[model samples]
Target: MPAESQRLYERIAQKLANDISRGQYKIGQRLPSERELAQTFSVSRPTVREAIIALELDRLVEVRVGSGVYVTNTEPPGGKAGATDIGPFELLEARRSIEGEACALAATRIDDAQLAELNALLTEMRTENEKDVMLSEDADRRFHETIAAATQNSGMIAAVKMLWDARTRSPQSRSLSAKVRATGVKPRIDEHTAILKALRQRDPEGARAAMREHLTRVIDALLKATEVQELERARQQIAEQRKRYAASQ
Candidate 1:
């Protein structure tokens, strides 16, 4: 296929996948007909079908015969908020910038009621993490979200939530997370504690530093995982080529 046509299909697929991740199309929800999609995207029916095929490869949606296409439980394929193709690294960089400011603002504004609730969430996270690491991480998300909420800025809250959403929706982000999970690396409770401590002291600089440090650690971990992923890919390619050579002989 020509590169231009392939890119168009990929662009369409990424747009649709972004909508699905944002809950415009719920799981099990049927997508518009190909004819409708083509019209909406200003493309041909064949182009829409190709986009659907790409999404299907990611397991983000299922196409049924004589019925319709529907969303699946799998996360979407790309990050489309800032740039055409935002990778996980870029998304995290954006978060570290925005969320550090959010934490700083939250320190000045958080109330006692909110502080107590945050503490409760941290406790729950620690308990659940002890039981099952992945399942417990929902609290980790909520913890950051709550900090954004304390800032009392709806835009900041939305921005933070969108970043978290992309972490799952983007294939590169998911792959990095999966690699880290395979290594049994769980969330660091001490890090969350540091952020909370800063918040409790009503120290904006401390809170900012803590949040920045936490995300920096996350970026480091992801970098390490990506290196491992690349190494494993090289190993697999070598193995496949050796098999082909032996078979030819």
Candidate 2:
């Protein structure tokens, strides 16, 4: 595409994203089709494609193949994609990005009481049975919340709460809670303990390292699961294609 065309579409995409963020496009609603977009924007279909790609990257919309683009959850929208509808994956990613820093901040700001609360939560988690998912998950959730609280940043705490609340409400959040229970079976009882100790000592580097190690496990598992799901989808598509070919014969 020409440079001018690319720039034009990028501009349109940004405008649409701003609108979506402002609730111009209702959540779970479909946006105009590619042809409509091309006509409306006075650009080619390819330009519309580029625009959609940009919107997708912004998490303002999700392109459901063979259907159309749909508004994704932002603020004031419903929860996740599943029945439980906890929230959007983007929010989780955002929280991870910010809260990890919060942990480092908390390390610097932490006091005796905050350290005690964190330790209390960790202790509760250690005694939690594998089958007691709700309690165990709640404990884990509280630990992060406490960490956020320790940072003394209300905005950061609020943002993290929104993401975590959304996540807990999602049906697929089971994937997370279950993963926590399963992968955590070895009992990293000392994981939060290590972080709290570091925080108490005002070791920002140590706190950040601990947060990185903890969140890395989550990122790694989710990536693997996404890959597996993609492979399965591909296999199903191939099987369907083969069946249609045999019927045509």
- TM-score of model number 2: 0.52
Clashes of 2: 4
Candidate 2: tens digits of C-alpha lDDT, residues 1-249: 344644565667766766777888898988877777778888766456546655654566776644678898553233221121322334355666777788999988888988888888887887784456567667888988988888899988998798787776544444434544543443356667777777888998888888767766555554333221123456688999999999999
lDDT of 1: 0.77
Where model 2 places Cα greater than 4 Å from the true spot, the runs are 1-92, 129-131, 174-187, 224-249
TM-score of each: 0.59, 0.52
Q: Which candidate has the highest TM-score of all?
A: 1
What shift in Å separates residue 162 of candidate 2 from its native position after superposition? 1.0
Q: Candidate 1 at 85: error in angstroms?
A: 5.0
lDDT tens digits, residue span 127-218, model 1: 98778767766888889999999999999999999999887676655655665676667678888899999999999999999999998898
- In order, candidate lDDTs are 0.77, 0.67
Superposing all C-alpha atoms, what RMSD in Å does each candidate have to the true structure? Answer: 12.4, 10.9
Evaluate residue 248 in candidate 1 and report its C-alpha lDDT on the 0 to 100 scale: 100
